[model samples]
Target: MSRIEKFCAAFPDGDAERIEEMLHGYLWDSISVRDTAVRKNMKEKFYHGMVLGLLQSRSDWLVRSNAETGEGYSDILVYMPDKTGIVIELKYADDGNLQ
Candidate 1:
């Protein structure tokens, strides 16, 4: 079976399309982080994109961000239907060529 099929089996009545839309929008918005904060912002945004992508593609998942931390999270958190949560963390590096 396809991955979506497996995912959907866990969430019979959820809208997969809406999940895709949210993931697309979240990823598209993340592209704006180019060189400004370079190291920090890109990693955080990429991690966030991954979390959002999962939330969007999988019906049995609900995602949330902690506004209190204000971008200091290890990664975005995704709560899955299996009653488990995932924290996605991203790390990036500069080769000393773009100082």
Candidate 2:
């Protein structure tokens, strides 16, 4: 079975804590801080690609990057088959130019 199918099956009642833990673990285990800074100037696109690659592994989830909303673009958008969608925003923590 696909990863998404297995995930849904494992959490038949949609356990939010388990799902969050799984995602957190995946981010910690699969992505490396060193691997994220391969170039001199890392842009949001780079981070987006990293996250997109991870989400794409789930055969049942549809992932979109920089999707336009009514106000602005969302950094990452995840659509589940039978549940609410997920919207993710990426920002530089040290950047002081946020509005």
Candidate 3:
């Protein structure tokens, strides 16, 4: 089986919460060297694109970037194979303020 097939087989329900947990853990462990801050020059769009690619690669799911919603535009929208959708909003904080 392929990587996507394996992931789908492992998570048949396309559990957004579980995927979120894993993704969060991945970002937490993969990055962050100074308490809660990351290296300089890495902006919001960079992380946003990275996450978009990661999600697509991991699950091969249909993901839309900067999707329009009733309220406003969202940073990311993911369509799961189980006929569910996940919306994500992204934010950025420069070196000056992240509070």
Off by over 4 Å in 1: 3-47, 66-74, 95-99
Q: Name the lDDT of candidate 1.
A: 0.53
Backbone clash numbers for all candidates listed: 0, 0, 0
lDDT of 1 by residue, 1-99 (tens): 665455434333355565445545755766565523455546646655565565466655676565234557544566676676555444444552433
How accurate locally is residue 78 in candidate 3, as Cα lDDT from 0 to 100? 80
Candidate 3, 14-65: lDDT as tens digits: 5756655665666676666543454554567767886677667744578889
Candidate 2 displacement at residue 97 in angstroms: 13
**True-structure lDDT of candidate 2:** 0.65
Q: Which ranges of candidate 3 are over 4 A from the true structure?
A: 1-42, 58-60, 95-99
lDDT of each candidate versus the true structure: 0.53, 0.65, 0.66
Residue pairs with colliding backbones in model 3 are none
Task: In candidate 2, list every pair of residues with a backbone clash.
Answer: none
